[model samples]
Target: MYKSLILLLLNTIFINVLWSNDYILNINDDMTAIKVTICSKRPLQLTSSLDNATHYLSKTSSHVEILNGHQLRLTKPDSCHWLIIPTNTESTAMTGQLLKVPTGLLLWRNEQIENDVINVQSPKAANAKLVNHSLPLPKINHDQYKWPKEPSFMSLFAYFGDFSQKTLRISEQSGSNLSLQINWLSKTLDSQYDSLISWINQVARSFVATSVLSGEQTVQLNLFASHSSESVPFAMVYRGEGTSIDAQINPQASLSQLKTDWTLYHEFAHLALPFIDRNDAWLSEGLASYLQYPLMQKASVLDEREAIEELWHGIRRGQTNYQELSKPNLTLAQLSSNMMEFRSFKQVYWRGAIFWFQVDLKLRANGDSLVRLLNRFNRCCRDLNSIWQGESLSAVLDQQIDYPFIQQLVTQYNNSTQFPQTDRLFNSIGISIANDNQIKVLDRPKLNRFFANFKAH
Candidate 1:
């Protein structure tokens, strides 16, 4: 009798331990179970069968669990997804009670399941608006930020702000769009924000889809003084306040005067390109840089001389070695990896734009222009997914102009060793290359001859 009681007690303890080791993610659905193991090591590996299921892994910060046998059961509450398994875990300690807290990646699959419902707005019943405004303002003596009465397609949200003292409020309205309220503590600051909104909305009119014009789609542009990440986490950032059109008083150099100059034109230009996936990232980024100067000139926002100078600037600062650039293009993976290697190569931004500029110049010489090329891209290809890395673009050009010459131009641009001598090209454009490496337009040739009418502005 005594022996029997001890055995029963041990069994009860084992059940309790098993239940205690589980981490409940409260998932609602299940899918094909891909075997995954977690470990406290450098690399995690999953079995070959789970290769197709690796994309759904997400890491959570709520709690840590170190299982005994160094392993624990991972389950999905629902049944339509596949899970990815991590490879670095030790199989021996696969199941048990934890000894210490360790960071482990959570692996799972994408399956359709009902999400737990919760009320997001109910907590703040008294205040209808969600507002945060602890951002520091520029010392410039001006109230610059205020939204216009005219309707706009853009909306904005800011986080990590103190609402009571500072001044901005963003909240969803009953309609599809959101309400943006910017209260500059200083009136001058309000004016700055107002000017910013005016510029943004003016450019945004072309960006809104025609079908969505009446339908509600929220687009917000959040501007803040600084982010913990230093640079803007997103492409558009609130760097600083400008006291004058030319003087960008960015003390932190949040947005350098030079970058701001480019950013204003480039960010606005993105509306013209297809924004579906990474496939078109090359075209999108390249086009943004390519169009920025031309568009600015068209609007009479900058001088044609200045725009050409900027293009030349890109070429000067751009990469010269074609082999190093081509090495990354051998495979998609290498190309992606090279993007992260900022120290080694010039980004697609500079190099790609310069290449397009050369292509444009070459095309014009052959009686074809970028305008024709753009119309072709817009009509023939839907977006990047439809356009693969092949001879399709080249083939399209052949129909319009001299295909052989265009190909030779592209080859020259792609080859780092082949570059037009700066001194020669600059002089041809009526710009003199200075000994100190500054662009001096000897005569500042007529804008009509070089760029569109807007460039002469």
Candidate 2:
């Protein structure tokens, strides 16, 4: 029932980057089976699927098959040939086999492909050709990368990396444009991914390209069909880390069919925060959820009134869910024992987002805004290599704001399952909801600069 509510939750499940493996990908005419030729380095003990790739492998033991539930262990031959089938299973915890880019387009992680060369062979294409890619060989920093204990055949697993530039779909621009990373994964110009590419570039350039948030960062997207219509379409970002993020959306679905929420913006929001443990997931997902509204408006992806109204609506959703399902007399602390074992996006995302917004609304009342506070954090720690936890982020925010706002909000509210009430805050901002699922923004003096953060454009 809550499957749809958890779409954004899966977006940031980025893991360790796959190091190195050369690949020759051949797609069949029916789109059902794929033949992947992996030329890996030296002795190999394990080739794991970060998502669910091994599930589709023919498990005859005669061929590559699922191992240890999630990993794919080769049967023989240090270098191997594996066939992949298209399947319909979806889950963040267990999905890494299939490369789900746009229809007729495939997205492979940089790690799965070989370091030096990769070849693409699709029945629908002109011919099998080497894909000229942009990822420089990762420096050989460690010597421990040897064939693990087992059938010793290889020396080293080249750090080819997952989510690589080799998959960009642009067919032309042979000269200078090959170096430019801002493009799509499809080779055809008429592809819907091409149009989506333009829209995404517009959003990044206008909203995040220059913001203190995203500076000189490159994003490689691995697309997939949305797990469900209710799931939020989200992108897992890997600006500096490997095992980069994976996002889900209906490959053939038109932009109009996208959820009313700005899915891209929401996923992009994760880039604003450092990764946190799943236990404190609210921190990362909350920042993504909260910022999506303002940034979506900044990019003109959403109207100002629409952004605020959707936020207010989300607040109600969180509050109602908590009221109905939460334990009695719970404290809103970071480690609230009442927290659900499986975790609900309603609490972790919606309520967590409201927690921060509530903190911001109050700070704004005193001539300060969360925008200024976060910008302060970005100034010193925006480097992609550094990961910041939610607890530490609150500490850093407190330092920037010169007040204990985030600290207090997180400590006070995060300890309990109780949601921070937003009725007063919503009313103060002047949003009115009429009967037939409609919303109107009222002209309130306090509402004047409430959206100043969105004016960055």
Best by lDDT: 2
Per-model lDDT: 0.37, 0.49
Encode model 2's per-residue lDDT on 1-457: one tens digit a residue: 4775475445333211222354555655433444555544443344442334355454233545455533455555444545454433342111222234221111232232235344555454443222222221121121111111122111111111122242222211211111123323333212555545555554444345324352323334544455455433556654322223355655556554443346766766665555555566677767777877777666666667777877777766766666676555544444233356534456667777877778777777777666655555665664432445557767777877655767766766566656666656776677666655466667655454676643212
RMSD of each: 16.2, 14.4
Per-residue error for 63 in candidate 2, Å, reads: 32
TM-score of 2: 0.58
lDDT of 1 by residue, 48-125 (tens): 112222233333222222223222222322112222333223311111111110112221211211121111111133
Question: Deviation in angstroms for 214 in model 1?
Answer: 19
